[model samples]
Target: MSLFQNLKSELIRKPNSGKHLPFVDGLRFLAIVPVIFQHANERLFKYGNLPELKGWEEQVSFLISRGTIGVFIFFAISGFILSLPFSRENSKLNYKTYLKRRWQRIEPPFIFWMTCCALILLVMQAYPIGELLWHYLATVTYTHQLFYQEYSIINPVAWSLEVEIQFYLLAPFFAFAYFQVRSLAKRRSLLIAGIFGWILLQHGMGWHLQPWKATLLGQLPHFLVGVLAADLYQKPVKWIRDFRFWDLVFSLLLLTLAYTWTEELGKTFLFELSLLGLLLSAIYGRYTSRILSLSWISIIGGMCYTLYLMHLPLLEGYYSFIARFGQWSGYIGQLSISLIIVLPIIFLCSVIAFRWIEQPFMKKKDQKSLRSNPIGKQVLSKA
Candidate 1:
């Protein structure tokens, strides 16, 4: 291969979402996989021709649906990733530039996918343009939940992105409060409180409430946990040590639990604590960290945004197309078949978006510290 092609080929595996760093990308990988599973699992019952499940099948289906813990993981990862810049010593945020850069990096691909998905829907489903247009506008503005108190009409998964954007706008302020206290004990104590505080409030106020569940207040605990992780990640973290197999086991156990959990808005105190352990293992566990840091794995994890944004739309197309072939019965066969068919398509499309679309934004140098960078002011100099 030519040198330019070689460079691009290698770079394509490096996800630019949060520094193209293995540790964060690995976590991203962890976060995105379950989300895909959550959706796939949900779709199996819908498109899989299975009757309302009974016995263990019904119970298992409900538990498998808990793959949404990945979304909460993403929230924590965002908190951890964004905290790097603002959490650095003597840090001061350039509010306007920060917001601008965030938009520039994230908005184009988001808009592209949204527009494409909307157009495809219009053409295929033949929804009235007036209704679709209004929903499209609302989705674009991230205000769909407020109007409809539900997932985006254009992109069902965009509800999480809406929550993400809410966190993004407020992250710096949260950081300000976090970093203000000079005492480490006091600062960490504050984070712990914030974490539980939000969880308690959500559960206390009833997370089942429609519009409120869609907001940041519902997910703030997860973000706070991420902030706590950032603080630990920036140093050797005196308290954190690889417990060899135990730490690895700890991570796996929590992951299994997260996959099976069916409960609150996914920002509970135990969940937040579990995120810290889960992420810390990925960051610090000798065995766990090595596996997570594998080049290919982290590379795929980095492209999670594309996978996330495009998965549902792609699935819509896939199921429709596959319906022509035949339908599969039994949840087991359906799950396996859907994943085998759908995952490859999602990855292929994500690679294209990552290399051509997202990477260009990363090339626009900013004063942001990367997770891949050694905990400091190491700017990503675009080649």
Candidate 2:
């Protein structure tokens, strides 16, 4: 198969698997693009600090400030996708297999990039070898988020990976508990209550926990919202699916409201709700936006994890090379130039990483191939 075809097959939901949802890939695209833009915006602001573009910088920053919301959307998507298997009737839990699959999917590219970033930082910053080793260990073990809250030692985005790992470990328990509740109404009610309780804990009660902002407790509501979304996906509500135009309208409205809320609590609540609305619209609402449903968009979304991991480092590298030319006059010129130079590089690198480093681990064990080569199969199976 051609590369595009391979990506499309890998990304699109298989028709036979009821859990496969193509629109969700599109949603992933939506989540990752903002993050890329946000990082790019930060780089542009850092390097293009021209006096002429001061007013434009503030305006652009405000617009892209919500890029972090994409992370919340990602958390919710994780909750939804991970919990989906359990939502089905008579789905058996295989803890060993689950962890193995997750490890294969998430770890290889992470380690590859983490090592690359660490090595680059070590040489560039000229840190002691021992200190660099410690930093590497902390980041690879996902401990950096707990001890080093200011900045990730290697890759800045790995902090979110730490949070994601926390969720991955607990997802089975969450799924089990979610299934124990017999009634759908009660399940939804409990989810809403959990979200409210989380809000109260984080905001009203002032209970700040370890790992600070990256703590699972602080982000639990978003994941719970995703769990709720998974339930909705399995047995979609007629009203929600039927409310096409209004669903889009309300989602956009919530997103707009999100801009006004500067506080973490308000921002989290509004953005999470907005994402939920958009997700529902993408899944159930009859009128799907052509932009989101496009094959190329979904393809990019499929490569999001790789894209997210690589974009920042690539941006920093690109900026270092381009900064010598000096800043462009206007915000548009700066943004356009940056995008033109940076985006293609990011996309190309992500695709290469996805194809080689990531995709190999995603492949299912080939029993036929294994049977043909007994000794090699034994080694592969053990691996």
Candidate 3:
């Protein structure tokens, strides 16, 4: 009993008592900034017409392309975090309750943000009101990804949300499957096989799926890696800590190979390795590192969702303005100046959105849900 108490104390030192994991938040920051940089790079390159300017365009393009790895990180993190709430109890989680919570958590922010985007587009006369209304409703339903035509009309980042929604829908089934497997090794084997089958299916069906759509299923491996990592966290695997350096090294090598190969399969393969390494590294590092544990990153990390949703609009406007009146001495100059002004404004907007929009709605929903549960009261009484 004393040994167990000591072990618990050693592991319980995470800031905020593990309610929020800083390394995961740091991963969020990593995912979001690269995505933003990628979008910004896309805009700059298109506007610059590939003119050389201190080689900034090339650098931005490289970083932006790599940002797709950020999506993998997001998926892995989601897989782990979403499973956390269910880990403590042996009570067969009420699927209805699970679905309801998922819906409430994701829908409000998504609907609100998409509506604002649609309204902006309407006011700008970007599309007809009749078509806008149709697309708007479709996006709200999270069915926009099903129809190829519907996708072009809405926020493009939502393509990932579409896949994420599918994962959420299946989480209950996944949890049930995990619980049914009495042996840890068997469960891990099943997950690995499932991921491999998904990849092969994507490859086999690539001819039928539009290239982008084909690439969409490629994200499943990363999500599975997250689930595996979560399982590892619940049951400590001593080898994970010992293998940290190798994991990091191999992950980097695979990523480099993927970029050099530049194939769809290459991207998918590297993403999985990078994500698994990232999780292991975070765990081994004690969730604190000079590179990722800084205050600014943690703060920005909190606002990642807002930043992701709003960046396209901000970048579009910024790009339009720059093209109209600005030309840099070279590509580098243009990119530097553009990023200098736009990044801070985007950051500021993300903070405001988090405070005024996301936080308020999240607080209301959580409070209402907590009031409705009252399970804590029962637990406390027993204690």
Q: Estimated TM-score per prediction?
A: 0.87, 0.87, 0.82
Residue-wise lDDT of candidate 2 within 322-348, one digit each (tens)? 777775556767777779888898998
Model 2's C-alpha root-mean-square deviation from the true structure amounts to 5.1
Model 2 regions more than 4 Å off: 1-19, 52-57, 205-211, 250-254, 257-261, 264-267, 366-383
How good is model 2 by TM-score? 0.87
Clashes of each: 0, 0, 2
RMSD of each: 4.0, 5.1, 7.3
| lDDT values, one for every candidate | 0.72, 0.72, 0.64
- Report the C-alpha displacement of residue 255, candidate 3, in angstroms: 4.7
Off by more than 4 A, model 1 = 1-9, 12-20, 51-60, 256-267, 325-329, 365-383
lDDT of 3 at 263: 43
lDDT of 2: 0.72
lDDT of 3 by residue, 1-383 (tens): 69846633332213211244556667688778878877887887666554544465565566556766676677887777655444444525456555555565457778888998898899999999998888887777767766553354668787778777777777656755674677888888898788767766766766325534523464566678887777777776778766646434644643563364234665556556566766766666543344465656656776677777888888988887778665655666776788999999998887767766765443323444444443221111110
Candidate 2 weakest lDDT stretch, 10 residues: 374-383
